[model samples]
Target: MREATHDPATPLATGLSPAELRLLLSFAYTGAVAGPWPAVLEAAETSLRYQAWGLLTLCLDVFTRGLTPETGLDVLAFAVAYGLAQVGRVAEDYILATFPSVVATPAFLDLPAHLLIRLLRSDGLNVLHELEALEAASRWLMANGNGQEDLAKEVLSSVRFALMSGRELKKVPSVAAGVADPKVLRELMVESLAPMAQLPCRVRSLQEVLVVCGGDKLTANLAARKPSRHLWFAHRYLSAVGLVKRVEWRALGHFPDGPRFRHAVAVVGNILYVLGGKCYYGVRDTLASVYRYQPMDDSWERLASMTCGRSYFAAVALGDFIYALGGSSGEIYCTDTVECYDLTPAFPCPRRCQPLPMALCGHAACALDGTLYVSGGCDEACQCQASLLRYSPGEPAKLLAPMNGQRAGHIMEEAGGQLYVAGGLCQRDGQTGYRDQLAFEVYSPKLDIWVLLSPLPHAHVAGGAAVLGGELLVLGGYSHETYKDTHLIHAYQPGTRRWITRGTLPHAYTDFQACVLTVPPALQWVPPVVSGNPPPPGYMP
Candidate 1:
């Protein structure tokens, strides 16, 4: 095999068109392909044909990032054909995330039987009910007609028909007619609902783990706040005798170096990047250090520090770069400076982006649809802000509708295309001091409006917030009124529009980072069920 040439017109031994040859050669040389998705797909196929693993990887990344409801099936099929398991997994996740919309797309009708089977078999399918999954499969079968009887039988085994209730199961016959024999479907339903023999438990996919990282911890004796270096993640959930619910947590070793708080963390692919923050209580203790952790290897590597040390700032990963926005820095304290670090470049350093219209600290931020949204932080004057600002590189930050009220030290996370803000400090009743903000609010980007949601049952100030299992989780943070840290985790499900206690952390922790990482299967653990009962009401953790 020979390396591709720089010449645009050069013909390769491969039967790709001139345009595709150029696209492949460009990716081989400059590591970038410029064209529509169809052209890129052609080049990707060419890379696979020629055993060009590197080019194929780049193509896979493009496919992964470009995935939408419309393009997910195509990407999944391509990834499966190329034996790119990781890309296929990501495509599967995207498809599951937008399953309802994906099923409505024209591509859904054209999905091959095997690919449809692969999707239906996933435990992570984000369907509201098993019946919806049945409906999707039935639609596919009806479109392809009776020739897919084998596919229908496969769908029967692939779908979790047992998860449906008696009333839900009644609808199975109508859906099963084209996909599988009606009588056989009934038998599966019966066996699944109640089996004489013990069967393997069905749990949601553990492809990603929810990790709680460095935070401030309060000792048992009501002692001083100490920054912790501990790292732990939820290993498994237990269903014990007497309906006891417990979540087992496992340690994944400490983050390299000492503990810090007010730091910003973000996940790019499977890697976790821990950014600048304060190492200790002193204002001078702010750090410019940066490091990244690879969950698969349980290892960490220090990266080039930011241009300036920052604390109480927001860091979000957007596209190929990480943006460190308004936070308290050395000398100036609260500064409006913003920096962007390119993850693709070796030895990357921070590049300045358009600064916020005003300085912010104790603020929270998250990325959605490649745009960065920041809200609820204090200015240098120490006045809380309710302004919602939208930012992008090379563009002036635009302020949208403000929050219901001023807040700081809050947690802002994006779930289902909307931004959710909860647990913050805010002034009320003309009081000089700040109190916990319990009123939760959500922002709609499309309408440019903010509306209130049910307030957190408990105040969550300065806690770690992340979306896991399709719910917004508020991890350990101290309430402003009590001045005590909590280890309990609270989850807000969008469907129910209510908050429920998920579980507790290994210990009382606050001011820490929370983000999900894709850990290798070797590091995952599922403990045996224990004997106990549910935590009593008003029980913390």
Candidate 2:
């Protein structure tokens, strides 16, 4: 290979150490094609106090490889001071990706104000429980404020105190003690006392994840026992690096009432509205009872019942109302009737609305742009239908363009201003009759069109599905051959146009409902509290 000459006229060339100068010459010779340039740049800055623009450009090429964990913080400080925002952001991403390791390091509290603010504003910071973020913010302010109350207030403003638990908010002054301005502290206290709706810092949509509800399962002692059933809530958190972890299935206290399956769940604000479903296995007995679950307080309360019992229905929250569309009622396999529940405190009962033109069951529904879209369900005849339906508040449902394939027990969700349907049961060749479906399709309301995208890795039906972090997560369903529950969890990445297995559910489950819930700001992972004695001070739960 031909040797390349370094441009001595390059900025700060004279200040470069021998190692840095060699790397710089290589960068110049190869037109900045190199590996591990961040290491080279770090050495250059540490020894020679020089930042070669060429070397920085090379570093960008290997950004995806990530920075060494030990060097990430130092590089971030250097990047910020040099006004290399793009580089700083990459460094910050690395640091945040390994947040659990860095969170306890003293360097976390010593980060410059600008870098701290940038990390706090990131949606990826959801990896840190809100309380941890709060503590880090307080420590940083206390360390860097230097008795400047105004600067302390400015730094504190970036912390989402409204999302913290009421108990944590009460200790804010003690946590921030000598650094926080009394006036600002008083304002925070007053704000914490206000109703949750009025709080300025609520959980953002990206921080939310799908919570899977009750399902059926076979017990370990299978010889003489019937299949076991459960009424619990399953939740998981995705790391900043897109790895799903900490899958938990927690019981909603004891199910003194009964077990439910094939139900419908809708979230309006912080409350979960769980609607009707069958009470037992192989029993025609259905329910009209409704319950509201508040995760913040870990409490459940009974709500007004629907006009009639329903199961395998499509429910969606649009505006301030919850709409229950066509589904089976009692012995009837299907019903065309629709009902709307006014969520306003004055009228909590579900009232009859204009019925669907035809009955539907095992369908999916989602709200978008003040309209409700229903897709892929079996008709009253029990035949899979590809028909798509749209409904407005006072308007009767209208049929839109049919889907590319008939689907029932599929998943439908609205994302990026489009509607996506994936995995279901569809009629196959005459020899095969009906079979599980792997087909996927997208609909654009603006264009009035349907486009088939990549298919799922395998056929799935009755899976819990939701959009999290701008990707589609399909969890725990079954196929035709097995006829048993599946623990698989698959994620569809639009950028890659492929399906990747993210992680498995804690248990195999089917016939369950899933919806995203914004975690309470003050929620922590804490051990069980014993009676009488108070929890240890500052202990996270």
Candidate 3:
């Protein structure tokens, strides 16, 4: 034991050995010394062990500047022990970003069970798949013994089993065998397979949004020639900051054989029901065939055909029924026909409902509180009209207040007891050349009135629109000036009452359809850990 002058001002005069005292004094006075860093670090480590945390932190602040992957783990362990969350986060990120392979090292396996749990529970850990994280957690639990079973259960709970595919879940038993209780593990599996409405865990774990297909560049290029079979899903993810969202357009399964456009799409539970549309540019190419898509498995199955072939129609889901309204049938330019399909049965067929007061096509429709509302479309003469129709059960269609403008190919979505209509072709001043309209309007069912709101930033035609998370999202469509297709995604903020461009689609699409449904979160990749540097000053384990 060596000691120097006892001044309360200098806290370093405590129990340091001669070598540590000399090294520390030299570093404090001159900020430079000629000794092995390892020796100096050992003294700092001793200070940490003795609970001289202030002195240890001072030493680490000066020396931790040159930390490498090897030393990062030590510092991380120390920071974690001392509850220095920010410091631990930096060290963890550095290790994962630089020396990811360290996660597989024996040292990682030896991390205290509690520390392992903390790491696993961190949302920042971006593992390639939840299964990989599960495996690591399982390994740590097994090494620690069943005594940590409670902790192991808590650790495993953070794993997003619902996000895993059926194939991936099959491997859970093999990997989770000794780590989690059989009953607990079985509960997780059951939750994953449970219906979306009845899901007990992470009830809103997956954030689902509207997916638009076929309005892209591929569809435009093939429009004049032949239809394209390719289709894509526009997936949206909210970033950590919450201010900006990212959209990734992934390749969903394609349409069967012949591709179609101007189709009507509606979502009933998890299934997407697609109605009639034109398969080709030819007048005779109008299709009556219907199909349904299951996003979970990316499978499409043909459904019973509609009563009549049509294109540019509107479809809406009201409870267990889907209502398909007016559109053009090949020979007939426009029709007032309305049909409803009951999806409660295994194999369903469409039945004709009371026709509209007047024949119309290229219209927009939505169902709210058991009433069907249709607005702004081309009439029997194929001319744009400002007509609005309301149909209730056991009653004939009733004409409501007309829209401000004559709109065709517009989109309608209902939210918070109001109907929002945006983007379409409008005929003003009796002009033959139809103009693309940017005007946005909302209708209140209770008041039977239409109110003008902020117009779209970009005037689009035949775009797919839906209400998601209380915000209005308008997907890919085309503009008149360019006469070109656009993949632009525009979202309207209710708070601001303004439309902001969220992001562009992978490809521009027009006349495509979109619907929102809840699905699993996509998988991501996480980095690894490593070793080499000594533990930070005062680090316990």
TM-score of each: 0.65, 0.60, 0.58
Q: Write candidate 2's Cα lDDT for 217-282 as tens digits.
A: 545553331222344433333222244433444444323357777788888987888888877755
Could you say which candidate leads in TM-score? 1
At residue 436, candidate 1 shows an lDDT of 87
Give per-residue CA lDDT, model 3, range 347-432, as digits (tens): 88899988888888889999988888989888877688887889765588889998888888889998757898988888756556
lDDT of 1 by residue, 317-383 (tens): 9988999998999767698999988999876678888888898899998899889999989998898
Structure candidate 1, residue pairs in collision: 152-179
- lDDT, candidates in the order shown: 0.79, 0.70, 0.70
Name the better of 1 and 2 by TM-score.
Answer: 1
Per-residue lDDT value at 220 in model 3:
45
Error of 2 at 157 (Å): 24
Instruction: Name the TM-score of candidate 2.
Output: 0.60
**Alpha-carbon deviation at 465 in model 1, angstroms:** 0.7
Between candidates 2 and 3, the TM-score winner: 2
What lDDT is obtained when candidate 1 is compared to the true structure?
Answer: 0.79
Clashes counted in candidate 1 amount to 1
* CA deviation > 4 Å runs, candidate 2: 1-117, 120-207, 221-256, 520-523, 526-541
Model 3 worst lDDT window (10 residues): 522-531
